[model samples]
Target: MSSMTKIADIEAEIARTQKNKATMAHLCALKARLAQLKRDLIASETKKGGPKGDGFDVQKTGDARIGFIGFPSVGKSTLLNKMTDTFSEVAAYEFTTLTCVPGIVAYRGAKLQMLDLPGIIEGAKDGKGRGRQVIAVARTCSLILIVLDVAKPLQHKLIIERELDGFGIRLNQEPPNIVLKKKDRGGMNIASTCPLTQLDADTIKTILSEYRINNCDIMFKGDYNADQLIDVIEGNRVYIPAVYVLNKIDQISIEELDIVARIPHNCPISAHHDWNLDGLLECIWDHLNFVRLYTKPRGQVPDYNEPVILKKTPQPTVESFCSRIHRQMMKKFKYAWVWGSSVKHQPQRVGKDHLLDDEDVLQIVKKV
Candidate 1:
């Protein structure tokens, strides 16, 4: 059978199989097998020269990137045009925006690059409708704006999410706290800090065996399922925040809008009519989790016109801040005086490793 056929058969079996202690090992092995098959298929496609055409090579710009992903003509282009004031050629027909269109949105003193990617279709992860190319760009984004038509929001949302999930994009999720280290002589030692509720030793061993991992030390800090463990083993998954942009809200009633708004991490807006666009921008800002830092010169006041934007993840430090300003700034740096919630005292003296909070004023004191 073909790889796709095998994958389909495995999925069918996995779905039909009942959940119980007796079948957990079997289910885990099947999932691992399915993952390996997909990996092989991707590798083969890569060898055959994957999608690289159609102006998909968008230059990374601005502080961070937010990608608009959905089915064709779902107001992605319109939303991009409205938010960034960049023309993406919106139309009523499908597939109007073919290439990756990049636009910059200046919000709250930070510039965010917004990408209007080509619409993705079903089986996108399998390279349908230039889906791989679109998803490839989406993976680079710090946040994914899953634009959906408010009429059929849930239906399209599920399909688009499936596509992204298949491509190893875990939206609004943290990486599984499972570590697998390969050692020559360990002979497959498995340990867990918490109780293994979703996984057992048998299931874990089955999954590991499918990967041909003979000797390794595996540590599970949380009760993760088989798929999460597989993802951990794959080590290529990206945890990105996402917001479901339910566009064309003008067509829906207030009751419908109220129901749609109840969905977690969603924003209802009318891209064509420019309604609730502010709410969408606010949602984007919240999901981006950006840290703004102001630079205070030696004698002058802190420059608030333009603040340094940093990702809230990895928790920005003084050393990183110095590096952001200039590579050589750290060389002449002695210490910094920070004024923010991160410091106990007002404008406390701190070293390079001190972690900075949002809206912090930093004044670097270089060695004389």
Candidate 2:
């Protein structure tokens, strides 16, 4: 039978199986099997051509790329047009914005690329209505702005989250503190720093056995569950930061707005009335965690106009800063002078390997 057919069978079984101590093992095994089948299906599809698509391939620019994702007519186009120079068509109807519309949001001396993507349907993750292609674009983004209308059902938020989840995109979450080291003959050694309440020793063992991980060292630093463990083992998950842009607050009452405001990591604004966008921009900036390096000359003052923006991941250092400025600057590197929060004293000298802080001033001194 085909992978999809097998997957459907396993899913049906899982749905029928009740959750209890008596049937936990069977449920876990079935879930693991379903996961493997999905992985196989993705692998097969990737070998054919991958999930990428035409017109979805936009040139990434600015300090970071942010994708706007939501269902039909969710004020994504309106927000994009208000936030950036790029003019995306805005209409009252659904699915008006059919393609990826690119724009640039210049904020606090930092330029951020904003993409108003096409409206995603419920089954978009299953290759419906350019959903796979849209999510593929989101996978490449540093942050996702989940735009939603306050007038619509709040369940739409869960639906979008589910769609992104199926694509291995873990939003607003960090990678689980779990490690799996393969071994030839040492057998399975398990270790944990925290008390795992949700997952038991047997469940973990059953999961590992299901994946044919006969000999490996498993380490857990957090109290993560089986699904998270599966994600870590699968090793294809993308943990991207996301914020819920709750748009159309102008259409709602003050009491209703209070309810939307209570949602965690969300910003409620009215794109039509241009309300509370500043707060949204600030939230986006904080979520991005961009490192800004001001260029300083030997004698002249720092040029505050253009700052070298670097991503916080992989530990941003002076070497990364130089690479962003010029490719060959690192080879002729002597040392760097730093000013701001990264230094102990005023203008402390640092080397190529020195890590940088956000909004720090840097002066590169090369060898003769």
Candidate 3:
């Protein structure tokens, strides 16, 4: 049978299975099998030239990339037009924006690339409505802005989360604090630093066994469950921060808007009326966690007009800063003089390993 067919059968069986201690092992194995099948289906489709169309292959530019994802006619085009001043075809009907539209916005001295992706429908992760293609592009983004209509936000939000989850995209989450290392002779050695309330010995073994992992060392640094274990084992998941942009707030009442705003990591706005867009932009900036650094010459003043942008991850250090400016600069590397919150003195001389803070001034001192 085809992979999709097998997946469907397993899913049906899983849904029918009872949830209890006795059935936990079976359920874990079933879920792992389902995940593997889906991965295989996507891999096979990729080998056969997966979804392709015009405007799908957008060239990535700017300090960071943000993709606008939601169902059709949710004010995505209007948001893009207003925020980035880029023209995206807007209309009253659904699926009006059928292709990926790219726009650039300069925020806090950092240029962010915004993409108005095609409307994603339910069953998107299952490759329905060419969603596989749309989400594939989304996976490349540093942040995903899930634009939703203020009306019926919760239902659509859950569906979109599920779709992204199925595609191995973990939204607003960090990678599970779990590690798996293969060993030749030793059998499955499982260890946990904290009390794992959701996962037991049997469940862990069942999940590992499903992947034919006979010998391995598993360590859980934090309390996690079976699904997290599976995600770690799969090793294909991408953890991305997402903001739910509740657009068309002008149509909703004040009380209704208050409830919508209560949703965690959400920003309510009316794209057409240009209401509360500043708040949305600020929310996006915070989620992005971009650090801006200025370069200082030996004698000249620091240039603030064009600042270097770095991600908060991997720890932005002077070494990375040098590499960002020029790959060859590291060869003659010595140290950097800093003037910002990262240092105590006005311009403390620090080594390349020194971590940099936002808006910090850096002046590299190379070897003689």
Which candidate comes out best when scored by lDDT? 3
Residues 158-192 of candidate 1 have per-residue lDDT tens digits of: 99999999888999999999989988776889999
**Candidate 2 — which residues are off by over 4 angstroms?**
50-53, 313-315
Runs in model 1 deviating more than 4 A are none
State which candidate, 2 or 3, has the greater lDDT: 3
Overall lDDT per candidate, in order of appearance? 0.91, 0.88, 0.92
| Backbone collision tally, model 1 | 0
Local distance difference test, candidate 3: 0.92
Give candidate 2's whole-model lDDT: 0.88
Writing each residue's lDDT as its tens digit, candidate 3 over 8-87 gives 99999999999999999999999999999999988888899954999999998989899999998998999999998789
- How many angstroms is residue 9 displaced in model 2 relative to the true structure, after the best TM-score fit? 3.0
Q: Count the backbone clashes (under 3 Å) in each candidate.
A: 0, 0, 0
> Model 3: which residue pairs collide?
none
- Looking at model 1, residue 306 earns an lDDT score of 93
Error of 2 at 86 (Å): 1.2
